[model samples]
Target: MNGTRLRPATFKYIESELYAYPDYQREINKIRDEIINGQEEQDENIGAGKNSYRKPGRPTERTVTRLDDNKRMNHLKEMVHVVEQVYDRLDDTQKKMIQLRYWSKRGANWEYIAEECFISRRTAFNYRKEIVGAIASKLGMN
Candidate 1:
């Protein structure tokens, strides 16, 4: 009760976030390969005159930016899987709360979760604590 610690809940959220993005990870590797190849080709043509440069083509600024964006998207995707796994064993209410807090676009908070479930904020907090503890125990990280 000291300083309102929610270490377990925070940990569960983080773990779930990590598990959510398997597809993103796979896509990331492919993007990385494209980026690397682009860079290599760019280097090869740097001093080979405009015509040679035209053949392999330089790595465009847009390509670099797109690759970076794809990487970030992949990271977010992975986090979604991690969150799903962490909340999988929770009760329906607890699962909904976690999904709202971590997955939903509106960025739901304890107050929102409480309102949606017709419970007090304190009750919502307790539910989060219980669900997180379960997650930690299941993952052998308790």
Candidate 2:
């Protein structure tokens, strides 16, 4: 998929999954910060260690990826909004299906969701497909 379409779907899925449990947001933020800090430290170490370059050359290329705080915050905010919208429209059954399939870290399949919901596996698969289609349609996603 193209970047523009993929980003919204990703944001929606992330946001919806994250909001299901408030503690998840805190954990995610902490993990993100740690990753960013680790990258920054690694970058600093690399810069300090490299000294034998060509005479009067341009600075060595950096390998780490970095995002300014404003951009990061804006992306997070957009994700939160997208998730909230998706969550609001869902019926209880659809919400539970989404939560089971995505929000739960264990990552349940149709058989599992069906067993949990006390339905046949085929029914579970159909429900999942229908819900996914509904979510995509509601969000104007692919």
Candidate 3:
């Protein structure tokens, strides 16, 4: 796929939340890992990919400045803020569902979420759909 292609999974990840970890926590962990691992390996075939890449240093030398680590952290923070705003607008029941489904490390599974929310699995699924839709509308996301 092209760099900017909008895939179905993008919406899935946004709406259903793709991470097993708490929101923003995964990204924080990623930033930490990057810092510990140092710079990413250079893409040797700079101009050979679908997009042309101009070398930064000597014509033969390729230098990649790693600014995306910061961008990713900022994006994570913004998403967390939007989610918090939406979460605040939710009713008590919806908030309970979200907490059961997203916050607790052990309760962060569908079966556990259904159990904690005092609803059948099917009902939980439908509620999740509605809940995520409301969040999306509030956040202008997904």
Candidate 4:
């Protein structure tokens, strides 16, 4: 039995997506229209031969692989969107800290984050933890 648990009653699906706001609406459109629209176009006949690549007579292993890839991509895109939403929700400093600590190519060290945030390394580390925890909670992974 673990004492550390996320707070209760955080589900808010019906609410508007912060990622779909006017500022980032294009990103949402890309995900919804491109990925899902193509998914619908290809997924119409999953069991039949006419699928994915539109090959005839029993969709082959490649078609199945394509479908699986589409599904995985869709899920990954959704996860990215959710994380983007959480990123938007975080405070400005928190956002900067998170980006510096994670989104950077080499992944900035805590000292860098501390300097950027004008705080101690320990505080910077705590901010990163808090920001990441919020994202994980929003994605329903925590």
Candidate 5:
């Protein structure tokens, strides 16, 4: 395992983000629901608004442009999308290595994690470097 070429801050940020995958999905779902519900309410009130004049121009902006206009939503989607793309490229054991090393609250030592994964401790560390390097590359931080 060659040392990661990522800067220290970038490496740490990507390492921390491994723990945020679940939270990101939940937030995405919540924001998605909010957008859907808000749109539905707007649809329900469309004809009853005080402004009686129907606009002669475009009824709605393109969905892509409208989504891009939302800074928070766009930021979250970009973060999640980059990580997921990198994660999906890993093999199953590599994913398991990540789960044991980062996501496990048990704070298991490398020895224990390696034992569980049937790999050496050095291999476990190598897997971590690879994972972090992949994430950094995907984010254009490397």
Candidate 6:
């Protein structure tokens, strides 16, 4: 729970990622919607068959490869998934800890988080370690 198993940089990266989780989720949803819209347009054009041979319904290898190579989208999805996995495994108090530490508008400190959760400051820190370590391990950062 100390996050000692992860490299210092990785630990920091995971922390930043957790803090950015909401933004990342929004971006992911926006990207997905864009892709869907673009696909629909492409399907309409493909139905006309002016540039033929790609078929009307099937996606081409190039299209699939391009989607697979979208590093930003893939990374966002992975980060969101890892966070969700760790969050789901946490109890209500730990969930509250994450919400306080990462999602609070006022950027609550350990003391405030401990007070809100009815735990000691040390316990709040420990919850952070457990959550961060879980995320790092899920991300193969250990």
Strongest candidate by lDDT: 6
Q: Residue by residue across 75-108, what tens digits does model 4's lDDT show? A: 5566667667777778778777765655542346
69-130 in candidate 1: lDDT tens per residue?
77565565545454456667567777666666655634566788899877899998777666
The weakest ten consecutive residues by lDDT in model 3 span: 59-68
lDDT of 2 by residue, 1-142 (tens): 2223334555467436454544445655765565555443323344554574433422222212333344554455554566567668777766776677777744666777877777788876666555544445544665
RMSD after CA superposition, every candidate: 8.5, 9.4, 10.1, 10.7, 4.6, 4.5
TM-score of each: 0.43, 0.45, 0.49, 0.51, 0.71, 0.76
TM-score, structure 4 vs. true: 0.51
The better candidate by TM-score, 2 or 5, is 5
True-vs-predicted CA distance for residue 39, candidate 6, Å: 10
lDDT by candidate, in order shown: 0.60, 0.55, 0.60, 0.55, 0.72, 0.79
* Two-way TM-score contest, 3 vs 5, winner: 5
Of 3 and 5, the candidate ranking higher by lDDT: 5
Per-residue alpha-carbon lDDT of model 3 for 62-125, expressed as tens digits?
1223434477766676677667776777777667777766665544777777787777888777
How does candidate 5 fare on TM-score? 0.71
Per-residue lDDT tens digits for candidate 5, residues 106-136, read: 4668898888889999988888888788777
TM-score pick, better of 2 and 6 = 6
| Candidate 2 TM-score over all chains jointly | 0.45
The predicted structure with the larger lDDT, 1 or 5, is 5
All candidates in order of TM-score, best leading = 6, 5, 4, 3, 2, 1
